[model samples]
Target: AQTVTQSQPEMSVQEAETVTLSCTYDTSESDYYLFWYKQPPSRQMILVIRQEAYKQQNATENRFSVNFQKAAKSFSLKISDSQLGDAAMYFCAYVGVGQFYFGTGTSLTVIP
Candidate 1:
């Protein structure tokens, strides 16, 4: 069994600044995938970034990037030039075989 854990229940970032959200997971399997998903007030899940266990380079997309430490089982999300639209609930997830697990979620608030 695998589980994702998010230590931060809530986070706040200023507009145009940068913020990092932490996530950690426990799993026995060596092969799997990690992902960060954002859910806005509208309640739609958006994939922020994904990292494969076998990949050494972290995944990045525009203003979003992930710090994936496979050895420590840590995956963090960094948001650059934070915008008001970035405010949402962020989840850390793990997928392997036929199972998927998600963290409780961290609510992010962006201050302009």
Candidate 2:
């Protein structure tokens, strides 16, 4: 069985600042995918970024980047130049055969 772990229950960042969310996982499957999804108050799932297990380079999307340590079974999300709109619940998820397994979630607060 595979599972995603998010150690931070909540995180806050000032406007235009940066914040990193820590995550770890345990999985026996070698080939899989990791994702970070953001759900605003509206409850819409938004794909923040993704990293492939075989890819050595970290995945990045504009202000978002991931530090994927395959051996350690860890994938962390870094949000740079965050804004007030970034306030949402960030979840670390794993995708396999059918559905995705999400973490408990981390409530991100953007301080203006």
Among the numbered candidates, top lDDT falls to 1
Whole-model Cα lDDT of every candidate shown, in order: 0.95, 0.94
Error of 1 at 75 (Å): 0.2
lDDT value, candidate 1, whole model: 0.95
User: Residues 1-112, candidate 1, lDDT per residue (tens digit)?
Assistant: 7889999999999999999999999999999999999999999999889999999899999999999999899999999999999999999999999877999999999999
* lDDT comparing candidate 2 with the true structure: 0.94
Candidate 2 per-residue lDDT over residues 11-103, each given as its tens digit: 999999999999998888878899999999999999999999999999999999999999998999999999999999999999877768999
Q: Which 10-residue span in candidate 1 carries the lowest summed lDDT?
A: 92-101
> Estimated TM-score per prediction?
0.98, 0.97
Clashing residue pairs, candidate 2?
A: none
